[model samples]
Target chain A: MHFVDMLVHRWDLARALGRPYAAPDELTRVLNPCGGSAARLAPDDRLLPGDRPGRVTTPAIDDRDDRRGPRAEHGGPTALARRTGRKGSYPMWCSSVLRRPRRLFAVAVLAVAFPGLAACGSGSGGAASAAAPAYAPAATPTATSGAGAGGGTTPPSTPAPMPGMSGMATGAPGAGGATAAGKPVSATRVAIQNFAFSPATVTVKAGTTVTWTNQDSDPHTVTAKSGAGPDSPTLDQGATYQYTFTKAGQYAYLCTIHPFMLGTVVVTP
Target chain B: MSRRQLARHGAWFGAAVALSVVGGEVISSVVGGTTSAAAAADDTATLRFVQVSDSHLGFTGTANPDVTGSFAHAIDQVNALPYRPDFVMHTGDLTHLSTAAQFDQVKQMLGGVRAGSVHTVPGEHDAIHDHGRGYLSTFGAGSAGDGWYSFDLKGVHVLALVNTLSLEKLGHLGPDQLDFVRRDVAGLSSDTPILVFSHIPLFAMYPEWGWGTDDAAQALSHLRRFSSVTCLNGHVHQLFTKTEGTVTFHSATTTAYPLPRPGVGPAPTPQTLPAGRLRAALGIREVSHVQGQTTLAIKDSVLS
Candidate 1:
């Protein structure tokens, strides 16, 4: 009950400040202000976040037969994400250069793929010169000797914690102790990190006990969507919750604290 | 503006309305006098009010470590508005935990705001374990049936609804409130511009997160006849606008921490933005209705 109240109070403060409430319940969701539109979904529903139900219906304003209507389609954040591919909002020139290339080949490819690298390059002349930097090593002799000495001695100390790099490497399922024959192990671990369930979909044998460990600082809970499934209390950072799949069926679960973090356990008999 | 002149500015008016949907970008959109009849109707709209929501007082988290401080800033923002607002409506969630102390603290803080009167509708948070006994005692004055009431401000009829109580999956406005809505607006003419306030969205903004009111369809049925109906709510603390025929729904932002853009993250958890971006996500909304214009100007200003 206290948790629920915490959600509602989001607006009271944000409303007073005229700002976005940071409560889990009060994200800045913009829906059509007018009530009972067949098309409008809750601001959160607009985003196809994992298993959440609700189709993305364009806001009614977008249905208007006006040139301005097209822009309204991008009003919601999900729409904005879809429009920009979740990439940084770049100027038209950069986007145009990137869009024209079908496959990244060479000079044009390098320039379009890494716009930042070609920031100084401008127009057709710049595009041609942009390739020169890539081909020409342009190594100073003094720097080369220092690099030769360091390359052998300094074991690449700058491998500074790449959390995302490790996360991506382990994103594929079966990374959690699968047998060589691809058979599910009796016990496996699922890491909850980066607000996502690593190996979001797992295939496990019946009676397999799946243990979930929270790696992120935020708390999370494993709750079933329906039927009897894994239900765990709030798992704080470094906490572990184990649920044994006794029956053979597909069990879908999510972090109740973070519903978009969906996971599935395929329990095969 | 004359109809011909208004037509000349048609593109500009269209742009203004389009900007409103993006939340806080467009300040106002004047419906040009396409029909002299709409233009001539006595627009009893000389009213301006500020809406503050989701303060989540007593909350302490990285999303917003200083909710009270930010809420105080929100109060300051409201007081700093050029014109003294006639009333300030806090849609709901006055506190993070529905403790007696939290209620008293919010009441005192609200008292300091310079407005004619402060009004509020109970958010789900306001009705915790005791089922709103604490909230009602603190903020429920002259309200009917679990803190729902209506009053005429200027020419507009304003209805404060209670939809947070008895919520199943979505915010629920049981039969009593539904009946109240039907009877409340039955006497008013179809032209009366109505403003409906509730903590949860009276529309189906998102049922999965309980962001919407389940039975709001029935409540809204009673309002379809009105020429202009604007429903303002503050759950899903963000600015959103939707127009369904005569009815328009606007979801305001919060004074607390900002939540993720619907489903951008794993949950609607409070977002901990980079050090300087939290202010951009928090804001207050000012709504103005002119004496003779059908459109109401809603402006959302983020906390500086």
Candidate 2:
């Protein structure tokens, strides 16, 4: 079928399946671009095609000037039919068939297509297109409506790997074979020198472990104040210590040996 | 006139005149000697000195546990200086936990300094538990209300302001104290140097942490008429200095412990350092003011 015909057919199917259709006025504007009115759609309107004769009718046009009427039938549909030389009889057989099963069939079609049209209008299709697997609800007959409906956009279940990843990326490998969130965790090597910790402030996610290496000749202890209790063992020169911060806050620390040396760590969840 | 009458009258007049001349000579001699002695004392200039603050003794926390040791060490260092300071001034925070025992320990230790008498002010910690009762009992004899006092050293007019009491969000110099300062320096000439010492930083270093003094501007405003004013403070455990017009504000580091750098975290408080590095963290600063020079040269040295 032509694209326009296919679109109209789909719209009709959606409406027939109990899907909400545009209002009558909107429908008329969409269907009849030349300005069809609601009165034209009434059951007794005679402008309907032959198979559905008298689908619409107006009393003013049909029975105007009744006193002078019937003297000469020259201005009405009857006159027009005579002029055209077509039969005056209605198509009784077609109307009879349309009266019973046709209405039931239209209702059934609308009932089947209503949910699909509603889902499409709600932008669930866009969500499905972005991360199909992540957003895919469950295995069900209705789930098929999600596929190809969102134009292949789907949310990613796992973050994409990138070069120069700092092991901070979720699911990326870190130093010492630790992975962020279940992947290989990456290592972050921080050095303490000149009585000061390099990168005095560091930001990391919860469960990410930070390792401190003492490069200074003297020994230093990583002491957090009493309330800020996630602490590390005192690391001597050429020695290393590590701690995993489970909670998030500003952890201000200094070398127990060198009180002047100070650093901070910020953990974000 | 008869010879006898003339001779008697002349003798009486001559004796009276002679008495007047003797009285004049005696008065001149006494006044001249007093003026000469005062000039001699003035020629031997009085010593001017700087005030160090917040040396909290017996603070065993990491910020600086060996606070007393460092302070004693600082005293020894000061004593060993090439030129003996006229005297030393300790603005306040003389002890970490202001116990009678701590105050006693500070007195004994500071007594060993051969330089001169040490002037003291109260710190929040020193006054927190005792409400300054013990501080006053130990050091209050010559001091004014709540240990606020002033004295003259050399040519400088030194004022020790008590801010620990009436401590607001920042330090406070209440109306009474301000009025005292106004009257205290009212008679001094503009050329006379002035030094104001308090426990908290007079300028707004970091008000959220109570590192600054409120109403310092009022005290400072009173001092603006003077040609030279130096304001020294200690609280943040670090060194910071600023000069506004004729007033120079200096924040001295704590002899007890080092605090977190300002605004580096949610709030700033004393941080614990390793026992071995405590001495390195604590230090003393010396400020020398030459009379003719506009600037005071400051030297900070760590306690080895």
Candidate 3:
């Protein structure tokens, strides 16, 4: 169930970002919570009232100040509010409060009594009241705004930090843990410079997290064309991306932004 | 007795004594000197030649930035020898990317050698880029169409094989070149000494890495009748010597870089050595073949 929710979330993120939805098999493999902390939410589960079929409309989120577009808005309640517009303000507040330990206790009792009512009157009560004026006729007590309200608005000016979403900083395993898992086993150092990865072939252990540090003055990405582990993120210059493979395979990767910069990581078990 | 008679008697006695002394000296010299002179002759005829292979000059990388310098150092070692070598033979890969500049540099550096002559064969690296055009342009004529040529010197027939060009399925001498070698050696007596040279090993050193020639057996068949056949090759930049029947295969070191030992790792490619140890890793060889000898004496030395 949680796996499906993660997949749905990922699919929504992909769609919002104007990317093709990951195939079902790819989603099943990548978003599998076999070893992760995120509990798998089944496709039928009603953890979020908005997930119920026909019970809730698509929430319209607005981002009026983001320069890169609406997809650039990161995880945060404010960004979620902006994405779903005024009508979604209450649901966004409820999700934030549900994520909090203190408010989760209060909402737990409320959740059992009235499953649909839990979406309203949670955190950020100020924004919820102010956004009530924008609610349209179709807006039921549960209905949220659709994609049209803030579709063309400028993205949010401020980036929001998602409470439970692991940001890039904490996305990678700890350095000591990564090292203990056999990082840099090849004793070979490959430097990515001038938008090109040096020593195109790098051999490492299966559990080793090969860190591709962007040394180019411009922003670049290290996207794997093959054998990339789940949660592998693109990195910018001066930023680093690490992938830890649990199984031995040759991971052929190239910068998605710069297809010419090709490289391969040979993971040995 | 007259003074003359006394002097004569004394002179006769002195002459007898002087003759005894002279005879003793001659006998001692004959008895003691033979072994020393024989040893000295053996030492004097101990011909040594440096076999530097796969110089691959004009390569610029951390693997081997100063390939030319390392090669020149090998030459310097050859020049600084107490007994200057008769000649030097580079098996192949005299250039890295096989550029004209690389060949020119190699030619100029090799020209500085005081040896009698320097023989060469083409390596895969030499032919891969230009299909051996630049190499042929620089070192063609005397070499046959594909650079397979043989010459006799100091009682040894040195056959430079062009296996790189006429490479078989697994790097071998094509039937045509094999026939050429057969015809080249058919006239020579069976007792004649033979030294075969090629870029890739005539024996199977490492087939997976393309180290061995496919039809080396066919090429070796022609020289089986010879008293001594020494096969020397240089594709892998390390020294490995193996003997099969009358043939001895010796792979020479590269002046440019080192490669992982066969089967030591997943694949074999030129490895970048530490900045300081690059010179010591490059080596040279000396080969001396005596007439009527079954074994060719070889001495290996590094540039450092």
- lDDT leader: 1
Per-prediction TM-score, chain B alone = 0.80, 0.76, 0.77
Task: List DockQ, one per candidate, in order.
Answer: 0.03, 0.01, 0.01
Q: After superposition, how far is residue B182 of candidate 3 from its true place, in Å?
A: 0.5
**Candidate 1 per-residue C-alpha lDDT over B1-304 given as tens digits, one digit per residue, 9 for 90 to 100:** 3434444433210111110111111122322213232223333344556778889887777877888987887787667554566678898989865789999999999999897688999887677556688999998889998999999876778899998766654677899989999999999988777889999887655433456666787888888778777788887776655544456677777877676543232235567777775554444333334444434444444444
What local lDDT score does residue A169 receive in model 1, on the 0 to 100 scale?
A: 29
Per-candidate TM-scores read 0.52, 0.44, 0.45
Classify candidate 2 by CAPRI docking class. Answer: incorrect
Tens digit per residue, CA lDDT, model 1, A167-204: 22223332454322222334367767655565566787
Clash number for model 3?
31
- Which regions of candidate 1 deviate over 4 angstroms? A1-67, A70-269, B1-45, B279-304
Sorted on TM-score, highest at the top, how do the candidates line up?
A: 1, 3, 2
Task: Report the error of model 3 at residue B119, Å.
Answer: 1.3
How many clashing residue pairs are found in candidate 2?
38
lDDT ranking, high to low: 1, 3, 2
Q: Which portions of model 2 show Cα errors greater than 4 Å?
A: A1-269, B1-43, B274-304
**Lowest summed-lDDT stretch of 10 residues in model 3 chain B?**
B12-21
lDDT of each residue in A70-178, candidate 2, tens digit only: 2112222222222222112211111232122233223222312232232233253323222221111111111111111211111111122222222222221223322
